[model samples]
Target: MKRAALVPEFTVPSPERLPDMWPGREVELDGLKAYVRDTPAAAPGAEPAVYVHGLGGSSTNWTDLAGVLAGRLDGQAIDLPGFGYSDPARSYSLAAMASHIVRWVEHSGRGPVHLFGNSMGGAAVVVAAALRPDLVRSLTLISPAMPFLDPRRSLQGPIVPLLLLPNAAKLAARRMSSMEPEALASMVIESCYADPTRYPEQRRLEAIEEARRRHLVPWYAEAYVGSLRGLVSSFLRAYLPGEGSMWKMAARIKAPTLVIAGRQDRLVDIRTAPQVARLIPDSRLMMLEGVGHVAQMEVPRTVARAVFGMLDELQEDKAGRAATQQVATQVRDGVRQRAPRVRMAS
Candidate 1:
């Protein structure tokens, strides 16, 4: 592919430089709003990458990573329906979300993309990839919520249902809002990290503020409940034996994959990393020490490096195989010519 010359640096007017709240144009569906960041490339076959964020997160969560990836490949960061700038559909389920993603990828003319997902989004991507392997070139999952039967350790096992209990989640949100910002932030920190103090105070405050703002919205509780129900139902379905779960889907995935996690993630224990690695045949695992649930957010460069390293390895392996095949073809042709001469003499 021909590369375009880099644009010269220049200052922009305030109006031009200002960020758009939704970042990109909205893809409207009945009763739902989907936001997308579409970066057009000057050349063809640039390879498209799509990123999906986790629960309680918006497309903005991937701002840093998306920028890095977009520079490397034509890419988009999507606000999954019911999260971030996206509004909820009448029926919010994992299947529905996955289906929406599939439609969006197809609609974008970027079917079969390099797919990236975090937490719950990771699970959704995994299911989607398994169901539509032809639409995925590769996968990168960060702290994916895989199904676990152990209730004591898994965060999704218990809290998911609680969040789905009709109006119960709204009541809890109301109560949570009443607490002091520092106290609420600390509570969230305790659940998300091994050591809350390791995280910067400003980042923690930002998280608290985001949560507070989300809670204040009237429809927030309904959205939360619907999403939680979908997550929990998917988790349960994935845990079942034989045919219908994530475990089954994991074994079906043919795409090269990278699974990343933080050793100190309190919500989803790091122990699940090896299991995920083992389940996905073509997958590699990377675990970072002293990090928490949001490893990419906490260490963007590190995450980017790990992801890019995997891509490099995959490329190298492909090139090596091609070279080996070429050499083998040459040797076979030489043997064929030699055999023809010997038969002529005979």
Candidate 2:
């Protein structure tokens, strides 16, 4: 395939240059508000890459990374049902969230796509690609949640996991509901950062503002717990015997894959990242130093370079395989010609 010059990577923009929010609108798919990235010129037929954010996160997570890849491919980041400004489904499960993603991709008429997922979103895309390989061309997973049960922290502090106990969902929701939006945002900003002080001040305000917007949703608290519960349940099932296992889903995925994580990641442990890379055949792993859980957000340009490198390698592998097949065909034809001719008996 002919190509345009690839997008330049690793040019980390100043906070002043980074948009507080990307231009977008909520798309109604099956009556759910699927907010997606609408800027950054996308090349036609280049296969759009869909972005899925982690638990308690929305499509806004892809803001920086999408800009880095905008020139090379079309991009869209979904606010997966109930997390962003989206409406809730009757039930929220890992499988159902993944299905919602699949439906959105199918509905958009963009298949064999370059799929990107972060944290819990990583698990969602794994399931989506496993269930419908035809819809994915490649997968880029950043700190995917694959069952590390050290729920010592739940974005707030060490005791948040205790809220998961039986008959605790409502109480947890009520307590979380009572906290100010800034307080919640501050906890997230603190937990996700390797140096909490370094994450830009303007972005901090944007995050707090984003949190305030979410607080306006009638069921935001319930949805948050529901999403968390679903992720924990998924972690437990990842080890079980069946097609449901995350390992099994990962093994079943046919798309070329990339797994990346930060050495200083506190939310999802870096140790678990390699286990995912080892389970998924032919996948690549890149562990960044001095980075945290949200690698894309913290160092968008660097992550873009890694993704660009992966795509370049994937293309080369395809070309090499094609050449090998052509050579084998030539060799077979030569053998046929060199073989002794059979005598006709009559």
* lDDT tens digits, residue span 1-346, model 1: 0111112223111122312322577886544567786654324656788888877676756655555444455768898776666776666687777787787788777778989888878888988898899999889888887766566665545665566456776676677667876676677667666566766655666667766666556666566677767777776787667576778888889998888888977666577766777888888788888887776666655677666666667678899999999999999999988885334554
When summed lDDT is taken over every stretch of 10 residues in candidate 2, the lowest stretch is 1-10
Q: Rate the local accuracy (lDDT) of all candidates.
A: 0.71, 0.79
Candidate 2 lDDT, 1-346, residue by residue in tens: 1111223543433344766577777788987667676545555545478999998888888888887677666888888777787787776778988999899899889777899999889999999999999999899899898777666533433645654677565665677678798898998877777777767777788888888886677676667677777877888888789778888888888788888888888888678778888878768888888988898888887788778877878789899999999999999999999999889999
At residue 42, candidate 2 shows an lDDT of 54
Can you give the lDDT of residue 273 in candidate 1? 64
TM-score of 1: 0.79
What's the CA error at residue 55 for candidate 1, in Å?
0.9
Best by TM-score: 2
Q: Candidate 1: where are CA atoms >4 Å away?
A: 1-22, 29-31, 38-46, 154-164, 176-217, 324-346
TM agreement with the true structure for every prediction: 0.79, 0.86
